[model samples]
Target: MSPAELAARLTDPALRVVDCRASLQSVSAGREAYATGHVPRASFADLLEDLSGPVVPGKTGRHPLPEVDSFVGKLRRWGISRTHQVVVYDDAGGAFASRLWWMLRWLGHDAVAVLDGGFAAWVAEGWPVTDETVSEPAGDFAATPRGELLIEGRELAELAPTARKVLDARAPERFRGEVEPIDPVAGHIPGAVNLPFAGNLRDGRFLPPPELRARLVAALGGTPPEQAVVYCGSGVTACHDVLAFARAGLPLPRLYAGSWSEWITDPARPTERGDAP
Candidate 1:
């Protein structure tokens, strides 16, 4: 469904609408924004808190996947049931919402979707806003993880060659190892092609399907969706790429959340310099 359609679902009590607006650096702003005003019946979910878990050493990927049981517990605590329709939104279109969308889909829930235009569009549309601080009544929602949706460092490393096409969603400079800000080391995983997440948007909103398809086709060359994986600094922005691909009717790529941040932290994980691929 479109972003506006998702917004229309806001008034539905059965739907769980979450506001995922928060910068990667500052999470407190999300709560404050929610406290001030948010879509009616919408609750605030901190990306790092509600969407991700503590970073594990060595074994898991950079933004290692959250414990399935813990995630299901969080869903239950949020009053989301298996049948509940979930719509996630953020200021940057589906940049953040796409993370929640991917997580839900990975758990085998198909009813979930990212709000197309995000909160900014909602406000622009003159939709109702509330600061009521919604607290969902607890419900039972069990989560079953789908292993195929995840790709560990080793898996990505092995697949980076002939198995799959690695797509880096960071800026060209960052991907090229020219400037490092958040990660200890810049550059990207060897063999990963650069496709900045911003490329998915045109003036803050996502590009139309045809445009997205054309851009992604150009990026992918001939590689099919199953033969591709998308990553970003901490796995947050890469979801934008995944959302774009989905919008373009392409297969969704596996996400590497621990992305560059987690990758550089481990010296054993190989690194590359300059833009070769």
Candidate 2:
């Protein structure tokens, strides 16, 4: 949703705004940003605390998917009901916000949207912001996880390059194994294609649907979205591409939540360097 559209609907009681401004570099960056100032009546969702589950060291990725029941509790505490329209925003494009957007969809809540251009655009447009925090009455949200919306590492390792086309949302350098910043292993899954999430946006806003469809559909390489898989370093930024695909009117693909971090946990899996596929 656009800032103008959100601004117009701020008075609607059923509208919920979430500020998702977490960082990979610093854990407290998102909460610090939220405490500084945010959209009026907007609540904050931290990347580690709210969006991710427990980290199992070598067993899971850096940011594991949060438990469904726990996330449902947070949704209710945020006053999100079955009918609420949710809008999530962040300063770093819509990368972080898309995580919540995808998670809500995974929970079967389809009324959620990422604010186009994110918090930066909201401030750029002279929209109002406040330092005061907001607290709403507890909501009644029931979560229904779509088991089919995910692909395990073992399944991805087996079917990729044959039955499915895997897309990696990490930067070219990381995807190419030229430089490794976060994860111990450098390269991506052997058959995964590079589709950096940043390419989906220009000036912090998503590209037009035609442009996105042109880029994403080509990456699909004749595979249907339902049969495709998307991932990133720890499965956070990949949702940006998923959100972009949705904006382009394509069906949401399965997310490899364990992503490259978990993929490397097993040394038996083949890793390819450079952008060949």
Candidate 3:
């Protein structure tokens, strides 16, 4: 929803707004930002405790999906009922916000949507923000895991290079295997295309749906939605690509939740450097 639309409905009792601003570089930055100011009536969702489970070192990716039963309690604490219209926003585009949007869908809640343009756009438009932390009464949210929406690195490797298209959402430098900043591995999975998530936006807001579809389809290189898989380092920003497809009015692709972090866990798995060829 646009900031104006959300502002008009700011007092709506059924809107469960969440602030998902976060930084991979610093763990506490998001919470600190939320403490300073955020969209009014918005509760902060920590990427570590709220959106992900404890990391298992080399065994699991950096940000593993939280266990559903436990996440249900988290949702209830946020007063996110199954029927509530949940709106999530973040500072860096919709990168972090899209994660929660995808999670809500995986839990079978279709009422969720990411705030286009995110917090940055809201602030730029003069929308009111509050430093007050929000707490809500318990709600009645539940989870029914949509296993089909997710794919692990092991299964992702099983797809023949001819049968699947893996879209990497990291920067060109990261996707090209020319830099190593965060992950232990530098190269991307074999046959992966560089489709950095930043391409989906223009001026922080998503491009118009038709233009977005053109961009996404061009990146897919004629691969049908069902035949494509999306990933990024530890599988966070990839959701931004997935959300872009959704906003573009296309069928969403499965996410490689373990992503490159998990892909490199075993030395036996093949890796390819340089551009997709």
Candidate 4:
């Protein structure tokens, strides 16, 4: 279904709509925004608090996967059962929302989807909003990890040159080693082609299907989707690329969540510079 169609289903009792908006530096702001006004019956989920567990020592990614038990606990607390259809949205298009989408899929819950265009589109459509906070009655949500959906740093490092294309969704400058503010390392994964996550949007909404296909094809140099893997800093923004590719009718790419942050952690992983492979 299209994003708007998915959003229209928000009020449906069978669906669970989650607000996945938390400023990278400020968790309070997202809750404050939600407190002011949020979709009817929607619950809030913090990206850092709910999506990620705890950082491991020597792990370079800005956000590391939470302990599986902790993640499962959070899911159960959210009342996300296996049978429920989960929908997520954020203020920043699907940039952050996609993380929750991906995490659900990784946990083997395929019924989850991101609300395309996010909160902005919802507001623009004159959809009803509520100031009252809603609580989810806790439900059982079992975690069954989907190994195929994820690619770790070593896997990405090993698979980069075998006709498999690695796509970086960070800015062209950051991808090219021009500037970096968050990560200790300055460049991207080796053999990665730059396709910034913002490229997926047009006027705050995702590009229509045909345009999305054209852009993805150009980005891949005609390489088919099956040959590509997508990543961004700490595996967060990369979901935008995943969503874009899916909307473009391309095969889903595995996500490298550790992404640039984890790659740079290991001193032995080779780094690139100056747009030269």
**Maximum-TM-score candidate:** 2
Candidate 1, 83-164: lDDT as tens digits: 7998888887677788888888888887787776788888887778888987888868877777676677656765537667
Model 2 alpha-carbon miss at residue 31, Å: 0.5
lDDT agreement with native, every candidate = 0.79, 0.92, 0.89, 0.81
Off by over 4 Å in 4: 1-10, 222-224
Q: What's the C-alpha lDDT at position 51 in model 3? A: 95
Candidate 2 TM-score to native: 0.98
Clashes of each: 5, 0, 0, 1
Q: Which stretches of candidate 3 lie over 4 Å from their true place?
A: none
Candidate 3 clashes between residue pairs 3 or more apart in a chain or in different chains: none
Candidate numbers, best lDDT first, in rank order:
2, 3, 4, 1
Best by lDDT: 2
lDDT of 2 at 2: 96
lDDT of 3: 0.89
Candidate 1 clashes between residue pairs 3 or more apart in a chain or in different chains: 3-116, 62-258, 63-258, 177-187, 235-257
Name the weakest run of 10 consecutive residues (lDDT summed) in model 4: 1-10
True-structure Cα RMSD, model 4: 2.1
lDDT of 4 at 4: 63
Clashes of 2: 0
